[model samples]
Target: MALRTVLSDPMLRMLALAVLLAVIIPVGSQTRPAADLLVSAGVFVLFLLNGMRIARSEIRLGLRNWRFLLPLLLWVFGAMALAGMALSSLGQGLIPPLIAVGFLYLGSLPSTVQSATSYSALAGGNLGLSVISAALVNIAGIFVTVPVFFLLGGTGSEAQIGWESAERILLILLLPFVIGQIVQGWTRDFIARHGRHIIWIDRLVIALAVYVAFSGAVEQGIWQRVDASAWTWLGGMVAVFLLFGHLGSWVVAGALRLPRPDRISFLFAGTQKSTAVGVPLAAILFPPEIAGFLVVPLMLYHLTQLVVAAPVAGALRRAG
Candidate 1:
């Protein structure tokens, strides 16, 4: 994973463009209902493809490697979950309350399957373990992140999750994924034949998620609320989260005495966060305005991981 490779990523660029559009031309309230419907449909398609692409066999095989997978899960959701709680608690009066919540959500997310696996491979990792571990973590995330979030003080007037939100999560995110898994045996060839199309469609939905989420922030005057000082504070906190993630993953993997290749897989698997899961889940869990605000740290951390992982991968490769 070269720095330029991450920098040249069109998806990252599209994310920026989505934010720009959100700032400049947010969806109006008159169109909110329609936009909401469209975004929901996109999310359904996004997860459906995710299920189709990731094979059930991989998960079953990876589950047998508890020695490796268990530690990765605990480090990602447990240690990092506590880290986010501390950071969010410490953020009181220093940043906007909701911006701090971003830290909690960011910390609890699953490692990104694509970038983490790619970086692991670049660093001479166990690519098989990297792929399956990432997939398993993400699969766990759809169920884990929200409940952990709520239990960790994510519940209140601003961030409440009611029955309606739960139903939305099931219908929009879970049901489609189940359908994809059931039909994947039939659709495998079609998905493989149209891999390029699937990739673009995935990216478009993610971009639209960013657009829809950020538009609410724009409508709430995110720019006005997040000033120079707040931006500085936010930047500092994001850096802390990044440092904690990468360094913690490396140390924990070493302490576990994993072989070098397995250690490398754990390294990337523990550090990265998935906006694809985090954003849509946020939209369902919180109001669009609050979801937009909550995801700020997550979006920042997601890009930073791309930049940070390149060098880490290079270092690991050289070390290997």
Candidate 2:
């Protein structure tokens, strides 16, 4: 039972898969063509499944909660952007430029849906609020991210959203998601019965994306450029960033005088970054060489948030 619990833990599973892929895929014989195709297909399917899982009622509920939703959005997109810009500017020499860019990009992302909602429920939070808030933020992020990136000076002429990239995003991510939602009425039963399997699919896609990203980085001699001390510093910075983000959210929640459940929802939803969306967007927005570096902060933040938030959620649950 304990072993199963450990294996089933999303953070543990993600960490194991990422570490394994980072080590193996670089040395393996997976060609670039194959990796690209696999990563693209995986991202498409992942988003499709996500769309199918979210019900229309949830969307309606999310839209109605303007009082809570407005503040959450401001914190996620506005305050976080300021925090990221501050970090990048202040740590100019301390951290690698690309890694700092990674931090900025991470800040531009949306809150996580599955893990955030799950943790909120476990922490005895308002589960509906978590679900609706997470869903709404991600949907908004799809359109908002490009402008946010440009505003942060993270994009250049080459990185600008060309017709091809926009087409790819529409066809690969949005189209299938629309199809999924359209068919949800007919497929609702099957989705409910087998919805849990989607978790494995999500994990597999993330691992594959990590593997492909790292493989490209390895080919670009990422190791020679980023040494051990750099990695150590990057890891420390990521930890600090996540801790600060969580505590800041807590403070904001308190100042607003939010109820306990809403506060718990705010903490998890506000602090957690979406790896599922961030990885795919990075792959599309940046070249392979830099995409790997850009995603490193995201991966680190994802893991760190989970580790820190899990215990806090448990404590909240116990106290409740």
Candidate 3:
């Protein structure tokens, strides 16, 4: 049962895949270029699948819960960005500037859908609200992230902000998503029938993206520049940020007088960040040199959220 549970755990599987790829893939192999291209294609397909799977009715329902959704959005997009900037300024001496930018990038991202909804359902939360909230935030993030990126001083030729870059982003990310949504009705039944398998495909793409990102970083002497102490500091900072986010959500939920289940949905929705969106956006928006560093914080935050949310979800289930 333990072995089966381990095998079935998506978080564990993703972490294992990342570790394996990081260890096995050489720093500058001939396959690096191919892997990079594959990562881009995989990300496009991942988003396409997302567009197809998301229910429009759920998104509308989430939007209708403006009282809950508005505050959550403010915290995710505003407070987190402010916190990241402050941390970056304070930790400049301790960690690299690029890594700080990574934190800012992580902050600017939207909440995740799959795990947030799954955990909320497990915890007897308002699963429909969770679904709507996650989907709405991510969809809104498609437009909001670029402006937030510039606000955080992530601007330059290399940072790739401008009309051309915007067009490229639309073509690569948004266009396919729109196309998928348009065709979703035809695909919905098929998607429902093979939902579990499709999720694995998403995970596989994400793992491949991580592998490609880290491989590039390894070649650029990321390990040499970021020592053990720096990693420890980075890890500590991420833990604090996550804890504060979760706690803040709980406080806000209570202040809003949210029902227990809605509170659970709001807390999880506000606290979680989307790795699926973040990794791909980093690859598109940032230069290769900094992209790897940009995604490190995101990957760390993703893992930390999974670790923290699992037990919390279990506790919530028991309490309910």
lDDT leader: 1
Alpha carbon lDDT of each predicted model: 0.87, 0.78, 0.79
For each of the candidates, the C-alpha root-mean-square deviation to the true structure, in angstroms, is 1.2, 2.8, 2.6
- Candidates 2 and 3, the one with greater TM-score: 3
Candidate 2 has what TM-score?
0.90
Residue-level lDDT of model 2, residues 3-94, one tens digit each, is 44445677557756765676566634547667778789988888888778888888888889887888898888878866776666655576
RMSD from true fold, candidate 3: 2.6
| TM-score top scorer | 1
- Candidate 1 lDDT, 241-272, residue by residue in tens: 88998899999999999999999999999998
Off by over 4 Å in 3: 1-8, 27-33, 156-164
lDDT order, best first, reads: 1, 3, 2
Candidate 1 backbone collisions, by pair: none
Lowest-sum lDDT 10-residue window in model 1? 153-162
| Winner by lDDT between candidate 2 and candidate 1 | 1
lDDT, candidate 3, at 25: 72
